[model samples]
Target: MATTTGTAAPELTGLPLLGSLLDLKNDSLGTFLRARRDHGDVVRISAGPPGLRATVYGVFSAEGAQQVLAGESANFRKDNAFYQEVRESFGNGLLTSQDEDYRRQRRLVQPLFTRRRVDGYAAAIATEVTTLAEEWRQADAGTVDVLQDMARLALRAVARILFGTDVDAAVEIVEKNFPDVGAYVLRRGYSPVNVPRDWPTPGNRRAAAVHRALYEVCDRIIAERRSSGAAPGDGQDLLSLLVEAESAEDGSFDATELREQVLVFLLAGHETTATSLGFALHLLALHPEERKRAHEEVDRVLAGRTPGAGDLDALPYVTRVLKEAMRLFPAAPVIGRRAVAATVVGGVAIPAGADVIVAPWVTHRHPDYWEDAERFDPDRFTPEAEAARPRYAWFPFGGGPRACIGQHFSMLESVIALAMLLQRYDLEAVDTVVPVASAITLQAAGPARCRLTPRNP
Candidate 1:
């Protein structure tokens, strides 16, 4: 059923039955890098037993990525084993929806993330970041877990800017269960001995419970919005817009679909940003010189005020730092696609039904596009430097039409949070810790412990 092109692709073999699945699960980034280094751009990696077929073509070059993500995207679909993990945890939301379902959801959901709409959220984001800075300011000197703190901040910001009245309940549920939910999804995705989600395994039960709680929370929010008759512009929240936009028939999302969309926004919007922000601050804490430069830029730009979206352009250095952080450790490191038809990518044949992987983790560090690939250098994002590299070379937010819809929202939120935090607090790394690239997102295995000290303007 699955076959490569005329010239067979280099393949990475693993232990019998389990195959490369263990290698991938153990060290995904390392496994992908090793495959690319041993083979060329397109390498076939197989897992599972001899009788069963489970494979993914690891493509780690710009040209190869463009072919699958842009050039011949129609030949691929999100309905694949890779996204099956996401669907099991998140349901039939935009992230996992396929075909006409994806089309309709995208059409209805796209408007809420438009640049103008995202810009309107800047003030609230700035306020939330300022509030967080003030809270940390109270603890003049203390060590805090950067990832946990940032995750909380990102969740609060998303709740305020997107959901109106139900923000508190949503935040509580996510705070309590997101770690378990995210961990299960990521682990199950790469587990060779895949188990049905309904199976009463401990992990499965926990994930199921989290999903039920989240769904119930979403249902409550929807019900309140319906009873309150909140119109679009009445609350200017994402839920209100969906409620107002719904039609009797054709191109409208029903209650169930609406709940899925909200969870999508909450899960996707917050998780990726939180992970990236945690890494960004961690990187800055590690590099004092970069931290100083970021502080200098913030000082000069705002002089001493909270930052909003308008300040983003002026704080170019802060933006560059965030960009560079994502380049180094992208939140969604791998973009997984499945071949719906046999296709050729970078001159390598890809069999239909094969999982196609394009990782920013690999491409962002490709020697051809970067001078010092492993180094933490924000200057690489400078206008002139970035212009010199290939477009798909540093796609932290990904590429093509299916690229992350919350790119603008994420950027705005990160920039404001970074600026505000930098202006008011000095976060110094208290420990050397690298994040573990996991099934959901790249996350700190332990905690990103940092000493926080209030700074004077």
Candidate 2:
């Protein structure tokens, strides 16, 4: 069902000065839910003072999602204010670029994530996960912070996949400051007022410093790659692939292009996988029955051998578990786009300049599409059950042309990582209740601690 096409849209009312901005910022999921319940799917949330313009329409229906993300995607370009603000840090990276430049960049980088190329990365991913598991065993600790440990593993895995053997130095720089760098950028991007970096405010100063640190990491990586003068397409790593790639016009990606793309991949790729895996492990830990099933499936399929690219399809249960985890806690919870031209969605007439928000967190849990939506049930992702629902109902990686390029890599890496970990150890959540916090990516609000009991061979 397409959104009712009309001019009237219910506006979410608020106090005189603030509107719903503060609530939206503080508790985005809660705020969106309240608006959807009270108002219709197309609810207007207004913010800012009398003169300044700050208004965003929350589109919570699958129809609206298709309209903005797929059907009428061209009318909703990535030149939105949010992406503009994000571009300050991301530069003209694929995540931030629009139109021709975005398309060309996508073309050049698309081959790197192809099935063949990503399959080549399986051994390195397995190696990283295996090494992390061994270190945990050696520690012999009672409890480990799953979120913290997963973060480190994700960073190291991505570092090796992107840089191969020359990852030690770059990984250190990224690991140390990645959190602060992400927090600073997100904080400023969501702030109502745009504070200039040169203003020297505490937040501004912090963002500037973190920005420099992140750029330094990217710069150093690019510089090292360039100095090596390795033949394009000489190696299997992503950097090598990018160096070897030629544009439609037969031009190579320059230094700035390389840096921006690498930065986006580093930021978007690892965090999403790490957060989703943490949630999956946390959920599995809480459900012994499900964990047992997973273990049984792994044992039947791999027979205690390390998981590899070929084993991914054979481990259906592991894939289902990951899908369910993402359904409940999508890493990119909200997808926003600015209407470049006048459009009507779900019966509401949207003006040319309106900011439209499509939230997976909301739509994925909608009662119409999902049964027992809040429950952690991997069975919901079984082929039969998934085929029964709308295609857009469970899109954790988004849809259409601009959907996540590395989704396949993320999924494969996750399956391998989880299978290897579960094969060697049984994990239980230490924290009875883990809280969720949304930064650039959705993550555990506090430490999600887990106790690992090593399995005897």
Candidate 3:
């Protein structure tokens, strides 16, 4: 065990009463980056007025991230306000569940995400990609918003895979209502003070209404699945698998639990993967040399065939491109946790019950780990290079027991989609800078427009 220096970690200077709240709200990603740059890895960030003030210990180094997320994961818990906000809106699914509930959920859900099982969904993913490609091919305008299109594509693909026959209903509900829910979570998650959720304020009422609609759609589909008596062995969709998942110790998820898990899958599955795919294409479009390498790898490995699970390993360069994109723009830019007890991390003493965050957004760009950190270089992820870096240096899907369960599925979906898209279109970025905001997830706040020219044209 390492001893702390017995000194306070550096703190970012802020307003007299509000601390870092305004800066954080206005530009969270930039604020975090500035924190790391100005105050090293362990920086104390206080927010809100003194009465309701929240102070977070920002751990912004790969080693610090490893300590918080993986090494001493038990010491850092998801009991913070941000997670509570997410849980209230999204339900106590795997993402926000704790202790035994998390363990049980993990055991039941783990087998469903096994490499072989996740790989089996490649055809469904390819179908969505093909649909998008055809739409782009027929469009009179050469440009499209990659961020928006990829979100729609990923939602459709995951919805189809999860709900199967009921995909149309699930997609319609999510497409119409999820943005408001996400916005609500982000706004409340960060604000130090909030109006009571039951007060029927405009935001509260809208959020409540959307939550009910989301739950109702999911409950109806789950009910239909139950009525259909779909066993996991015979059924191909995720909902069926969840319906059938059972154990002697934990039995199975009940109706509400099932809805919660479905909601988690719908939110995490599409959003993170969509972020990866959108940014991967955007990065490639901006860097011609990297794009050329990706194109060559896709063409050579795929050879005029639609990308599938088997092609994942063959397209090494394409994988690296995706990895590099993730490094630059991790889907979950900042992850929040609360220290269960006093702990020493990166030679800084974090007091018990302190709100802590390990920022992949900063760690992925840590000066010690990444040379030319701002550059979009796929070669940074080559096998040798990856081995030389810390494990948490590129944690886009997070780390530890609480890590995102859909990681394999996200990668598989991204690789197949990127390969297929690269094979069909030559891309050029219409917007040079894709302004992003750290929302519930890392979101492209502005348009990520890209011009596509059919390769054969």
Per-prediction TM-score = 0.94, 0.95, 0.97
CA lDDT scores, all candidates in order? 0.82, 0.84, 0.90
Name the top TM-score candidate: 3
lDDT of 3: 0.90
Using lDDT, give the best candidate's number: 3
Error of 2 at 378 (Å): 0.4
Candidate 1 to truth, TM: 0.94
Q: In candidate 1, which residue ranges exceed 4 Å CA deviation?
A: 1-6, 16-18, 192-195, 199-203, 247-249
Candidate 3 residue pairs in backbone clash: none
lDDT of 2 by residue, 1-457 (tens): 3343587789898778878767776787878878887887888889777777488889988878877889888887776666776788777988889888888898888878889889889999999998998888865475778778888888889989888886787778788777876776777767667767689898778777877887877787777777887765677788878877886574778988888888888888788898788888989998999999999998889898988899989999999999998999899888888887777877787887888888888898888788778889999988999898888888899888889999999998999999998898898888868777566678677887889898854
Model 3: per-residue Cα lDDT over 36-79, one tens digit each: 99999999999888899889999998888888888899989999
lDDT for each residue of candidate 1 in 1-457, tens digit (9 for 90 to 100):
3234656688986887777877876788888888887887899998767767478898899887877777777877786755788786777887889778887788777777788888989888877787777777555357777788889999998988667756788899978877787777767766556778788988777778888998898888888888885545787777888876644444577888888788888888898899888889999999999999999999998989878778879989999999998998888888888888987777788877788899988898888888878899999999999899878888888778778889989999999898888888887898777657656667667788889877874
Shift of residue 2 alpha carbon in model 3, Å: 7.9
The true-versus-predicted C-alpha distance at residue 66 of model 3, in Å, is 0.8
